[model samples]
Target chain A: MKKLHYSELWCSSPRYWGGLAALTFIILLGMAAAYYMEHSGHWVTGMSNQVVWGLPHVFAIFLIVAASGALNVASIGSVFGGPLYKPLGRFSGLLAIGLLAGGLVVLLLDLGRPERLIVAITHYNFKSIFAWNIILYTGFFTIVGIYLWAMIDRKAQKFYQVTGFAAFFWRLALTTGTGSIFGFLVAREAYDAAIMAPMFIIMSFSYGLAFFIITLMSAYWWASRELGSHRLEKLKNLLGVFVGAVLYFSLVYHLTNLYITQHHGIERFILLDGGVYTVMFWLGQITIGGIIPLFMLYSPAFSDNRFAIAIASVMVLIGGFVQIYVIVIGGQAFPMNLFPGKEVVSSSFFDGVVAAYTPSLAEGVLGLAGIAIAMTLVAVGARMLKVLPESLEDPEQGTA
Target chain B: MSGNREQPKEIKRREFIGMTVLAAGAASVAPGILLTVAHATAEAEGASSEVRWGLLIDSNKCAESCNACVDACNRENGIDLLQRPQGQGDEMWDAQRPQWIRKVKLKDNQTGEVTNLPMMCQHCEFPPCVDVCPTAASFKRADGIVLVDRHTCIGCRYCMMACPYKARSFIHQNVEQQTLRSPRGKGCVESCNLCVHRIDAGATTTACQDACDKDGHQAILFGDLRDPESALSKALREKSSRQIRADLELNTGVRYTSL
Candidate 1:
């Protein structure tokens, strides 16, 4: 091993400016969509009284969960003493912060009254998990910020392990808080299970690592830097394990629901009868998001192909988003069981029937904006700070 | 000296007559004064914890065709005045519109018996809406009436998700006109407050209860559950009544019989 050198991203290229401008345009479009929704009301969106949370939540929750997982590389370096991961720690922290900011912005702008954000900040019910999450999200920023500082500043290196440990636990708690948001909903049949917390944690691991790998490869490629095959192989392998864990949790979640007679109807709906939900669960989530990525990463035929790895990572993100959609939207789409044995023949409130939701164009733009915001942040951070290593070439190749 | 003594005697006689007249006047007005003061005190105190306002609904008596309670609730809350925004579809508008109360028809799976009832907020003692509200905007009054403070509600709709009864409605469009009693607006979650304005105005009856009585059904009974001597309490004592989803043990302020 040789001494590592880090530098700011080279910004003189036309590609850098083009990417920034594109991200800016998307962000502006998102803002306009948000303004339209706010000006008209929630009626503009496909969300109704039945499906209170919609597509925006799907994107928002994905980013937030992935944000915690983005810090894994840094944790592996400082907390677990992995020297190979050390050079990646600074960029990990930067990505984590960027992702969180993007998620929070989408969440804020989608509010029925975004201006009353101060009310949400100042007033809190301690009993509510939502209030607890607000605190957890804020604390994550502070702790991760300190961890990034420790890794960057030479004088602060002594506190690296302490900050790393704090960041690690805080991210775990943050993901738990996000999962518990649904788990604690006693009224909704799809979300009452206690398994939601651990499931979300595993989900974060897969989604975050997948995102990290894609971004890392893109950055290195753009910089014309040599990223060794060994590092890529290591990341893809870790991603496979995380994806497998997510699948295991999904199996347990569905199996547990299947065993309980009470959850039979909802299980049947998601697995068989639910039109869009079933397709998304099997095709988008399980097959595309889970199985395909695993095959691409582990298959010997595609071992040397960088394109296959990138595609697998992209697929993982797509699958993760669909998984969230099934959870957030599909869960709400199922009618609540107000009467156990009695069937609802008539009701003004759309009871005993599946609620319909179709994501509007405004919602789509707003969700895309969150991704653009995150990418923009990472790009800006890389350009301004020495967060990226000069090269990840093998020490045996004399380019370390 | 004699003239002075005579003046004093006259004064004493005069004082005695005045005292008797004053005593008579005080006796005549004292009851009225006491009643006025008591009425004022009740109004000043607002909703009291000692009095748990509740509703006793007789589902057996509720007519399948009659929507008196729903109509009354809408009219009273100014929900009827809300107009759908331009270019909005009827199906979407129906889903988005606010409904404080609505009729629900249920048939027994095994017995094949039909039942008609009006569904609204159960006003639970341990309201899940209040529990899940991050801003504490969804709160229960001391008198057991659950309410949403529009001023503080960020319209996050967590309360809507938390509500088991499907009783809450989010205001989706701009409310151009609303009754002063309800003061509703866009971007807020609201539900049946059980006509809190009427309760505070010293009215013992709710709009639904009044409408039910007028329609010759008398299916709804509004009273103070704490007052055992009240009609609602006596009815509960004589006939068996159960709260909806009693297994949750929320001890809902609303109860139904002959379901």
Candidate 2:
């Protein structure tokens, strides 16, 4: 087998490398900000008491789901035996495993006491959604490890069939557990509904597809030189469906919250109020993450172009973060008890009652660090593992 | 320690068997939040089997004239003034703060409908805070009382998040300023310990309970939820008491009978 090689194209390709560099730079700034926050204190950032766990947590959770999801190769190969996808199989497992590792790093960095994360692991809190997530991440990582090793370690294919399925289902269960952490909060009224868990799974699928498609497309652009239109189209179409799923699920989730509980004042306050977060939810998540990607990909002209597909993929990443931010942060901003007194009027959403929380600069940077760390890992993995095929047999133009 | 992690060793058969046992043990524990910390605590060997502490609040008699419980609790626990008022950046946790408990008046009907509800931790039997606490820092004693262990609390504020009564508060700053009894200040969640310090000392009741214990006309009751023979439990049978937020299904330890 030919050892994988990095093309000069990777460095020269303004589109892919440029985006990668920009993402890296953004993440670097975030890292510096995070370090400062950790050294100084949470006060250095925008996070007030109202919105305690802000951007970093939201971004981390989004990254987590995305990381868990970016393992589509394991899902398709282990679940359905998609031999066409076999080349990408072990590599997908690597991405899934890598992204999760990165996500955990960002989350820990965001904590006021990173030292306690291990304490958290050793101590265990079956009741806290956050504690269970620690276990969930650990378990999910294990399954991916076994599955990836079985795929790549040569003497392992025979064992991997069992291992791959384990990894696939465990990742599914892990993501659901992650979702349930938010969903089971009967106290957090916004997060209590059944919709969130399934929404997470669907998001995993969409984000997983987006990540791989962009990565594979970048690799294909150089080594294969094939511009494999039909295959690329098929991949785009599949991604398009997940994007559609994201759109549909988001619409249903928000509308259901709005429609069923329209009279429920606090819920309505979140969905409609001039709260910046509410706007972000409606605009950034519902519009940018869901609709724009769908519009771009669902259209034939846009879907066919590799550049367009890549852009749509980027949108998926952004939109996913926005959506999670809305849930994790917005859920906290509302006072759970809803005590009415002479101080604040009944049925009024903004009677100096709204909890205020904003992610400090450190929180934002640390969040960025998560993304940077992911991209760096992917880049290194691509370079070292030779996961991307350095050669393609034939080529066809997109115009064909 | 910070870089790429080596591949985890594959689970050996022995480890698998061990994990299975652990999983089984974990499964036996209730699916709610308390399982996380059950091991950390020993079953308190208090004289159990007959102490049902209950509270009877005469809503008809509640006049917000005196907030003695807040004062007594503040003095007892060394809670700060929380001077910024509710919804501000003041870091201390106390009973009178917006995030914790407070007394308030509500009027309806335009003409009349005035009443006072001295609200605080209801200390539910099936505490949602206890159920959802990931670290299991928010613990319910074997005697049906809830207590927060300040040291173990990770400050995820999930208890604050899970609490239906809005009873818990997150210490925003390092709470070095504490009274001699339980000096917890920053980054941990605190609520009405229901005066646990007083209870453990074999006192008749908590400070608030004692303060409400006005001239034999009782306002707050403190006894074991497990005890059926206690006067508080006896009054529970006689008076139609209501919980602060029963809809949460926490099965609160403290019952309130509106007078």
Per-candidate Cα RMSD to the true structure, in Å, reads 8.5, 13.7
Q: lDDT tens digits, residues A69-120, model 1?
A: 9999889888888767788999999999999999999999988889999999
Judge candidate 1 at residue A149 and give its lDDT: 90
For candidate 2, the lDDT comes to 0.67
Q: Is the docking of candidate 1 incorrect, acceptable, medium or high quality?
A: medium
| lDDT per residue as tens, model 2, B189-241 | 67777766566556768776666656344566677655677777777788798
| DockQ of candidate 1 against the true complex | 0.60
lDDT of 2 by residue, A340-360 (tens): 322333321222255666556
Pick out the ten consecutive residues of candidate 2 chain A with the lowest summed lDDT. Answer: A342-351
Scored by TM against the true chain B, the candidates give: 0.83, 0.70
CA lDDT of A316 in candidate 1? 96
lDDT of 1 by residue, B63-124 (tens): 99999999999999999999889998877887899888989999999999999998899999
